[model samples]
Target: MKNKFLLLTWLLAVPLLWGGCDKPLFKTDEASIAQPDELPPITTTGEGTFACKINGVNWQRCGGGFLQSSIIGEWHPVYKIFSLQGLRSCEGFDDAVYINAFIDSIGLYPLEAGQYDDFNLECQDVLDQYFLLETADNWVEILNLNTDEFIVSGTFQCTLVHEGCGDTLFITDGRFDYDWAN
Candidate 1:
């Protein structure tokens, strides 16, 4: 009777221990970036949508916005700024991408519509915070930029170098259309 009880206890505990040891399905590799070749090509139709390929995997923004900020205190009338951001999600993970553009005389900020050798594009993910300004290998192009209607659109391709792990994420076919609130 005692031996049977011990055997039954071991059987139940073994499965529980094994199940608790399960690892995450999406793992970040230190030596190489994660690449998913099966993802479909990003849409480039400019239909007021945002999509991008991050590390070769499809990432689409569920929501995004354009915001403005102004320097207060002594510089109240001297400085006003605008910023654009998008949030991309995959497998419960969210990546936030941001762009800060140059402000105009009329307090309107729009992305520069042209190929840029360097820019201030930034991205933050679970693994790392990546930046385009760290290396000269990254580039961005603004296909369309309009501030009159409070809309800004663009396409970009960049190699975001991780700040902590030294890993790299290749972002390609990146496009966005941000409509700011009045």
Candidate 2:
């Protein structure tokens, strides 16, 4: 008698407890407007963030899956080269910006090709347009680099000249924080 009573109570109570709700438990505002792009917070503790404004529009890295990186940084001790690359792709459009600084110390480097060190910004835009660094008016600054942790943080702004047409690409408010070891 006791087992039968408990079984009946369990079945009756379970249905009433689970099926009593007539409305959703959580609500998301369907009429809510999308927010504008905001830059990620600058960090140096291996947050793997990279962002910049291209032609006054905000952009950030995206691609993430097996053995891939949206933001990556590396420092070669032998050659003393620092490399950083960021990639974003969506809606059949793609963009990439990268820098290879051949400097031994942390500082600002002009966007120029010189005998000792080379600093260049190679940007590929949405229409597969090619832009290369030309003039020295643009620059990149190495703000902080933690060699022990493989984290690098920096700021950059550059003007790249188009290859096909004689146009210019302005990259501003650029910042990156990456940990290659992670």
Candidate 3:
């Protein structure tokens, strides 16, 4: 009888210990945004940089470019077209942040500074993939967009949802300035 009781207790405790040892789906390091003095000088040589806070942690990318997608269809006043991607892929994973937006058209829509636009922002790491949660509320402000030079700059903030991990990551103070052609 004593042996049986000991075995039963060991079995229950083993399962509990194993379950308690499970790790979190995602983990982020604590980091702060870079100040103006810390930022690299803006380059005119056509290289672009993207920087943002991921879950309050700082992340930046030095490789990416801007382009426009072909017109898919017409939406009357404004053509229904997608701004081609300017993406920065995260190291060690098939994840990236689609950073900039460029509305390409003849004279239908003028690229205006300080205009807030909804963007399909995405971020993924090894563990999970995240996308913009509130499409309408989450927006990026165009700081500058020069059609002739093909240079664009912007700032953004959004909440990203990871369905697989059942978690959310808030990205804030996002900024990108890139000269598309080099």
Which one is best on TM-score?
Answer: 2
lDDT over C-alpha atoms for residue 16 of model 3: 81
lDDT of each: 0.47, 0.63, 0.46
lDDT of 2 by residue, 2-75 (tens): 99999999999987876677744453332242323797877767777877877786767654652343665578
Note the clash tally of each candidate.
0, 0, 0
**Candidate 3 residue runs with Cα over 4 Å from true position:** 1-47, 62-94, 99-128
1 versus 3: better lDDT goes to: 1
How do the residues 1-182 of candidate 3 rate in per-residue lDDT, one tens digit apiece?
99999999999998787677555334331222232334344333334655566666655543333222111111121442323233433232222454323354322232211111123223334434455675524655656556567665556666766665566767677665666544
Model 2: residues with Cα > 4 Å off, grouped in runs = 1-36, 66-69, 112-129
Return the TM-score for each candidate structure: 0.54, 0.64, 0.48
Error of 3 at 139 (Å): 0.8
Residue 30 lDDT in candidate 2: 22
**What C-alpha lDDT, on a 0 to 100 scale, does residue 162 get in candidate 2?**
61
Q: What's the lDDT for residue 95 in model 2?
A: 48
Q: Where does model 1 exceed 4 Å of error? A: 1-7, 10-12, 19-48, 62-82, 89-91, 103-128
lDDT assessment of candidate 1 = 0.47
lDDT of 3 at 45: 34
**Pairs clashing in candidate 3?**
none
Q: What does each candidate score in C-alpha RMSD? A: 9.1, 13.7, 9.7
